[model samples]
Target: MKEQDTVDLFVIGGGVNGAGIARDAAGRGLSVILCEKDDLGEGTSSRSGKLVHGGLRYLEYYEFRLVREALIEREVLMNAAPHIIWPLRFVLPHSPDDRPAWLVRLGLFLYDHLGGRKKLPGTRTLDLQRAPEGAPILNKYSRAFEYSDCWVDDARLVVLNAIDAAARGATVLTRTPCISARRENGAWSVTTRNERTGETREFRAKVLVNAAGPWVNDVIQRVAGSTSSRNVRLVKGSHIVVPKFWEGANAYLVQNHDKRVIFINPYEGDKALIGTTDVAYEGEAGQVSADEAEIEYLMSAVNRYFKEKLRREDVLSAFSGVRPLFDDGQGNPSAVTRDYVFDIDENDGAPLLNVFGGKITTFRELAERGLGKLRTFFPEMGKDWTHSTPLPGGDMENADFESFQAKVKAEYPWMPRSLLQHYTRLYGTRLSRIVGEATSVDGLGRHFGGDLYEAEVRYLMDQEWATTAEDVLWRRTKHRLHLTEAQQAEFATWFSAEMREAA
Candidate 1:
């Protein structure tokens, strides 16, 4: 490998943790390279519950530190990416049979005071019989508790971090898998193969980071020929999307008889996202899906609290992701700690930082602290800076999304309200780059369906490293949900032809 090809850090995953670390390291003046076998966030990051929350249920396990850190990071992330991360209110109906009212109040109290909540509202008791939020709840639930959290466009979060990292001089390789990594001459030699072009490349790096999520162990044992005392427990969590049944922007949280909590959140304008069964999984992480029993369990839990019962036919789509949790010897998958752990293996002056078990809410802090573990090696690296800096497209004045929306409306009077809102919410201040000199809808090139325009697809291809239809349709954006099956097929054909012509 050429001397120029050598970097300060080599990251082996392109999920949120990997992307975040790459961004942080690059920003701190470290030459970094991030490689992923699939598209960014194709793993657990995109398939998350899509909330930047304090994990109210985690309090039951006495995870005070994890909950506190996540709570504090919520507003920090919202400030960093106002367009993609914003406040969401959750109404939890009082389930007297599952837990007593006082215990519920205690949990909510800690959730309110756990972190230094500045911008978000505190918790409040709700009269389900009188409040509009109670309209969908069954008559048995006459009271509820409402608390604040934030919703995130999880996939976009990963992409934006990668974009920011690349902007800061990090090399991002998607559709590329790290084939082998070995310590050599007090450094690391890493070889990666491009799955698309069958091209192989080599790099020399001073340090290696394995943030591979479900495949962290594979990267350790297979790719690096290294081992750690820590192991990741793969817990499968699934979510189902259906037509929106209730009347508000707020989400509903129900307590199951099994003592697990289920979130029924508003999703994608006209849909509801309900999910998450915590069944211990022993299969390939990529092959995990919502099994029949899991789907029925989720539906039954929602049916227990809601006046509108959901049937199997009502399910529009389902997705499952394996949580690469740090194994804590817990018998129940749900009881596994959501806290992140870094196993630093410093062998003869060469170091491998293996990250395990972190959620989207704590990715930034995880990156910051992960880099801190390597400070001794890179003594000349810059001080911490990502805390105050914004991610790509999030650099609006004061990180104020509503103000930016108003400005977009004023700037593009000819754009339809829905289209403008879509662009503004997804792209934020970066909307102009996608819009370019387009004066009308026709300038956006061919319309794929819904708000997916050719110009946006082109931007994603050129800027976001999107090489496949699913990269654009599912990971980078959720156009697949809106586009009909035939429409999706047509768009895929067009995308392939466009790529071929460009090539």
Candidate 2:
């Protein structure tokens, strides 16, 4: 944390990949420093589809290696962090007008048998008329396919990895951007300035990692003063949230006329998440927003199969994110690969590792492989260990979240079911850190409405580098969706006035 300290590794991003690398490197006995220009996951890492799947559609592009690795990593992540990730069933309604029945069946067959399958159920045919999953679907789709995938709290996953990295002896600097990095004396001279306090610091590191999601190319050209043949294409994906119109915990996937698929997922308890129009984006990653055309496209796709039509009034919220896909020269943005590529510039004695495209489902593995690329630099660093290690709060036995829930209920009997569920789902074993021997609702301190309390707020500020209310409400937890606009504004005012250090 000093101004001119020497470290083994210095990472230049705070997204999931960078956080994962920091955690891995720290556990392997490397002195690491991870600096972020904003709050953790305040970028593409947060605005993801929130699913850990094998990319069933990638099969059409013949990305067998990517699919197989992702499929294998799905269960690995589920085991490492069960609190924020759990199994979910996806119901895909068949349409003879789109893809042939045999092709769909063959794709599902490969999805079932492609990677080692053990924890989740295999695909099965469903009678649309009899199965409850198809009750809201139109009768034209008589048959459906039910497959397995995992749901993730994308922002929380990023924060947890950063937390674990910090706990493993890595310095995490939020709201601090690396302004300059130069290679001198076979080391990296990195200088960072704090955006909040106008404080500056410098460090000498043995290696530099450019895991700056959307800004990878920018870092190469501007920050590092280095050039690379590799590049990333920004693909904009948009999603809309609406009231839950269908029953059951299962989600629905419908194929659009353009051959792209849309997911209708149960979200925030009483709402549905439908998304993703893949369009080539040239705008800023931070300024991305769901356009009217993208929103209309999502609704239209949902209406194609669902009997309950979705109008503009039903849309509660909408968000958009740009994917930093590795440019494969494909004209269609949807056809681009999600696989990651690495470029190592070992010129002039120092090394700069540039990470290209990657998806959330393969972040941990990506980190492992990223570290493997630096094996020559740190020969004495520890071997791979994240495979079985539990992240900060994901230490449940057998990763049984249901069993953990029962235990929590018995322990915090005084807590309401809704509040308990929220805390347990977000914090897991770390719930006690916030609860801290309090009894009853009043003991949790002033309620900010909808399970938002002073205790949780203080915990996030102290531990998770939460400087603003948006970090807590929108990113750390979805309290913004549950709380009214007035409540949110009041919380923001209270947070700013009461929390003087943050200001």
Candidate 3:
């Protein structure tokens, strides 16, 4: 393995936490190398509720610190990537049969004042018959409460972090899995195998960080040949995407009979993204899927609240992700702590930091704290700086996407409105790089239906680590959802040919 590349820190996993840590550490002037077994955020990170909120439900469990940190992070993340993360209002219709009104009100009040909320609006009471937000709810619900949270393009957030890290002089390797690691002469020797070319490479690092979300134990025990007292419990959560049934951009949160709340959010432009059931999972994390019972349970919860009923046929797609929660000896999976814990083992002079649990909303703060834990080892490292910095393509002035969209429209007056909006929303300040010198649609090359064109695919390949059609279609961009099956097949054929030609 060519005498192994030496770095100050080595991170395993390409999920949000891993990417965030890489960006943070790289910005702090530390040499970093991050390797992911598959595409960035192909794991549980992309398959999240896609919200950057304080987790209102956690208030009941008295997780004051966790909630407060996450609450503050919501605005921090929003400013970091205004194009992808924006404020969203959730309407929770009051149901007397469920939790009492006073309890819900108290929870909302605490949520309002718990963290230092600056940009987002606080909760407000709503009368069902008068307010527009309550129009979609069933007649039985007479009152509701609306509160603020931020929605995120979870997959893009991870990719953007990686981009930012690489820009700050960090080495990033996707589709590369860590084969093994061993401590040697006050340092650690790690070897990774590239899945694409079947090539093995080695690295020497002073510290190793394991941010593998669902595969935390696998990396610790099998890959690193180390042991820890901490353990991770795999809890599977599933989401089903269906046709939109309500008006307005607001999302609905209904409390189920089992004391769990389900979110029905407006997704993509004309679809609804409803999720997520909590079930103890004992199988392989990669094999987790949404079962019929889970689908029925979710549909029933939505049907009980909305006037427009949803059926089995309405489900357009479904996805599942396993939460690698720190096992706190809790029997109920729902009651399990979403807070993260670090198990730093410095037995053989070198250090191994194993992150057990974390949520998408708290990844940034978790990264900052994770780096802080390693401060004693590397006192020469730079100070914290990611909270105020913008992610790749998120350099809009004042983080105002609306004004940025207007500027894009004015610049690309010849482009179609839909295409302009798509590019502006996804790329923000970086749109010019993608749409360079193109004054007409023909300049974008072949069109594959919808808003996808050859120019965009080429941009993803040249800039992003989009090696396969699925990588571009599913992760880097959600073109699969909008393209027809035949169009997708054609695009795949073209993409494969282009890759072979490049090779």
TM for every model, in the order presented, reads: 0.99, 0.99, 0.98
Give one digit per residue, the lDDT tens place, for model 3 in 1-503.
Answer: 65556789999999999999999999999999999999999988888888888999998888989999999899898999999999999999999999999999999999999888999999999999999987888999999999999889899999899989999999999999999989999888999999988989889999999999889999999999999999999999999999888889999899988979999998888888998899999999988899999999999999888898989999988989999999999999999999999999997899999999999988988999999999998999999898899998889899999999988888888999889878877787888878889999898999998999888889988877899999888888888889999999999999999999997
Clash pairs for candidate 2: none
Off by over 4 Å in 3: none
Question: Candidates' lDDT values, in order?
Answer: 0.93, 0.93, 0.91
lDDT of 2 at 228: 99
Deviating ranges (above 4 Å) for candidate 1: 1-4
The sequence of per-residue lDDT tens digits that candidate 2 reaches over residues 1-503 is: 44667799999999999999999999999999999999899889889889999999999999999999999999999999999999999999999999898999999999998889889999999999998987998998899999999999999999999999999999999999999899998999999999988988889999999999999999899998999999999999999999999889999898999999998899999999998889999988889999999999999999999899999999999999889999999999989999999999998878999999999999999999999999999999999999999987899999999999999999989999999999989999899999997988898899999999999999999999998989999999999999999999999999988678556
Residue 125, candidate 3: Cα error in Å is 1.2
Looking at candidate 3, the ten consecutive residues that score lowest on lDDT are 1-10
Error of 2 at 246 (Å): 0.6
Q: Which is better, 2 or 3, measured by lDDT?
A: 2
Pairwise lDDT winner, candidates 1 and 3: 1
Tens digits of lDDT, candidate 1, 1-503: 33346689999999999999999999999999999998999978999999999999999999999999999999899989999999999999998898899999999999999898899999999999999999999999999999999999999999999999999999999999999999989999999889988888889998999999999999999999998899999999999999999988999999888989999999989999998889898999888888899889999999999998999999999999999999999998889999989999999678999999999999999999999999999999999998889988899999989998998899889899879988988888898999999999999989988999999999999999999999999988889999999999999999998888887
